[model samples]
Target: MVGEFCPRLVDYIVLVGSHSTNRTSSSIQTPVILNRFPPTDHEDFVLPPDVALFCQPEGCFNVVGSRPARANSDSSTPVRMPISFVFTLTDKESNKVRYGVCLNFLRPIPRRPEGRKHSTSSVPAVGEMPRRTSDVEFSQLPLPRNSDRRQEDTGLHEKKTQRARSSVRLRTHTLTSLCLITHHPFFTKFRALVEFLHTLIHKLHERSRSKRSDRETVWGVLAGGIPSTTSSLVTRSVQEIEIWMLRLLSAPAPVPGKTCIHLAVQPKALMKPLIFALPDKSRLPLVDFPLHLPIQLLGISRTLRILVCLLLEQK
Candidate 1:
């Protein structure tokens, strides 16, 4: 009997082992033994009639086997076992622990295409375009080509030259006129006669005013061609008159043929005796006088006679 039971027990252990490994691969398993047919006190006896079996996953298991099952055994209830399996597998080669495998069971991925290349003749080179010359000959072109502008400049220059020449001619004519007027012989003689007359009139007027009463008394004597008393003042006055008369008569007359004396004869006769009264040595004559008359009168009388002779010669 024991031999037959051992074979059955061995078969049951094999089945449980296979089932546990298979279930562990997919999930986990828990097995529990209960005291029923195999009681602890009757280990050498036959298998107990009150034994129980409990099976669960690897968590929350319990054992229950009391007496036997009259109708129901309290120990025959399913045991609950609390079991936990924490798998900590370490990989030494790549230093990575993998829990499960991820399978990519689809087609292979595609790669990106390579870039295309271009030929050199597809684009134009920088030196291929035609270029315009920046340097040009501007000086060779005809200058502004306006005949009116050239003529206007030439006419303006000629007008300025003519005005300068006309101004010079006008200045030359004015200078020539001034020279002709200043050097005229008639004008020279006329100016000299006027100056002489002015001097003679001034002297006569001064003498007349100084001797007004005496001149009034001597007016008859002078007209009658007679001599008065020989006073020194009368003599001096007469001398000044004589000198002025000679200056007037000596100047050249404007008329050619007649001398200044012939032209002025009446004026000479009227002034001669009045001038003779002065005792001037320049008026005295070279001829001898008769001794019967006073020396002063004779001297004066001779001077008048000499003046008349000179006048006749001049005429």
Candidate 2:
């Protein structure tokens, strides 16, 4: 639904397939032995494989062969990041979460607007997660090799190799991000989001068009990130952004960015400012997204509350 992506985002590719799973499972299923990203097999796997540890099975995903992806990382020490196998983004410390990863894969249980349906699925009981899938995909990454093999292996190696190659259209709820950074705009049902992005792009272009301004100023902080009810630019922008975020957070899709790990999957009240919980379990509200890409990164609300208690939370 959107146009092309900047070439910089498309250099390396790793493919993941989302399969349908029953969300009513009792607990976290044990992850498969070999996860590709976070490079479980190759040497780069010291950091926590938070994404693969979260997936049910297919530690298998694709990094196209015959074309080993090279990373520009020169740092001797590896940086810890969530594993979505876009190698260029994954390898660097600076790849602060690019936008456009799908988190929700199941059809949302449509609620009756008028009828009182007891919301049993809102929060998981103690240890249980409402959905079986994690927001990020945990799969093995293809380490670039100097040469391609003319022959294949047998038995265990054969099985692992074959299994690793399969995945696509495995689930209806899953979104396919073609060529890596290009997500189908409808991936989130948030129509207002595209509108806001188009507006934002135009606004940014308009502002940056001035030769005096060197930095592209597409960012600002607000009343916490959720915005107050007073109708203004910040309010309108926050509302547009949150429409999809709440869905991503509300039990299922909590369609997430890497920061989503910090945010609770439990639904937040629309009547209040949108908040996220830290690894420490401390509460922090969202203030603003300083980047065009919101799929992978989000910051905790620390800036000035541009608007006051003026609470008119959008449902």
Candidate 3:
């Protein structure tokens, strides 16, 4: 029976569709080689070097384009076949593009059991019944019909619950590890921003000492005049941060929940030192400005606000 139902490999040849993502204005044209049917051997073919042909057994004359149904199976249900098609396309610039599509229909074959073989006892004589361990007949033995079935069902349910819990634990661990990897880039950029902000604050103090008549405070000067040395660096770092936040926002929820919240909270916590470093803050007269503000320096306030809102909404 197994030999009768054993699977067989088949091959086919068909044209596959191809599409280009380039935005060239000129239209594609057919190559001169394809104009002739069955071009000569000397002519170049469009097949790519990377593509390989499928290998099949020798002496097999049959070419099955469609899956064949089993002899005893119902005709209504037809088995799907593993078939593939290959085609080539040429653009107006004479560049060849090869396309291949394949349907995966390979199924795993069941392996036979292998172990030590045991010798079977000889059958009893024709008229004699088989040797019995007890007087009770097999059919007459006690059978807990409903109770046994209930026990079996309970066992199956417990096993399923355990498997589900283990799977969830595995997923959570994976998420945590990936979140750490994602956090590294954000942390590096944050450190750079912090260092630059500190330097800018110190530079503002130096400028205040040099120019006695310039009564503008450090915060006021920052609000009005951009620093020459760290302006581009600050802008690039802010852009990087915004990009990281956007990526974290777009990532799969629940998996990235902890990472997102950590990102939102850490920024507020670290900005405190930068705010304290600002000299003459009391005389700045900037009522609208926040004392402990990292966004003023980074310029990613709007993006950060949107990110926080999105994260909260997701929660």
Candidate 4:
């Protein structure tokens, strides 16, 4: 059956219906590259050498990943994948800016379990200390039945109970259902990648949340401010990370003041920290993990919020 999982190599991903995230701008902003995927200016491992790594005003990059679906399913209520557009807030104005990647789930998303619509609780904030795995999980929930509600279960306390149950189910479903390659040697790269994501989130948040001037837009953030920019292998890691996702760094922009305004390839330089190369084929994982998997698994409603939570801690 074609329903079996296929992690074949995809040379490029076409980001469909990608639009600008600028909500307040009167003038329509154009994407840096229209319709063209990040090109392989040089040889590749996971992606081209010239991957779209950054999302800046002038040198913005684009990428997309689709939802996982069985190609040959014949059932009447077969699973359908929706492209839930995911974006991260760059500022109050650019709150809807695409996070620069459209990722995909590793497996087909399941139907929402049918039951009484209970109020769900707010997602827990990532705490200062490490998170402890909750004992309750989706695997532990008993199947709901027609007689699930009891005589006294309709009270306010029952609503609280139901909300707790719903929150547990939501988190558990995210943990179990979304499949991150369990044994992949990407663990080394995971931190680097997470740091990259962490920087993106923090930097964007800093720029957006802070009271900077509209005049400040001219002098954009520095590529050096982004993670892995200083390492000698950053150039190498960009190619390697592409094997896992769509792209990493945007093409090298000019370094006049070390910003994206001018266009210039960054000269290779070394730093104390290093971005290790991807493991050889003998040690690689499923070979690909979609960037938008969480959005498809859950939905657009909480996509960016959940991603922020996921990127909150490296553990």
On TM-score, the candidate that comes out on top is 4
Where's the lowest-lDDT run of ten residues in candidate 4? 172-181
lDDT of each: 0.29, 0.29, 0.30, 0.31
What is the C-alpha lDDT profile of model 1 across 108-157, one tens digit per residue? 11112234456665465667865543546555555664787889899999
- lDDT by residue for model 3 over 40-113, one digit each (tens)? 22133333322222111111111111233353554332233232222223333544332232221211111222
Each candidate: how many clashes? 17, 13, 0, 16
Whole-model alpha-carbon lDDT for candidate 1:
0.29
All-Cα superposition RMSD per candidate: 89.0, 29.7, 33.1, 23.3
Provide TM-scores for the models. Answer: 0.16, 0.18, 0.16, 0.21
What would the per-residue lDDT of candidate 4 be over residues 1-315, giving only the tens digit for each residue? 112111221223322211443322234233332222334422322332122222222222121212223545432222223212222223344232112233221111122334765558654556756555566875687877655555346676787987776643332100001011111223333334434433343344345324533222111111111332333333333344333244333322122222322211122462233332333335532333456676767788788776677899633
Better of 2 and 4 by TM-score: 4
Q: How far does residue 250 in candidate 2 sit from its true spot (Å)?
A: 33
Model 1: how far residue 218 lies from native, Å: 8.7
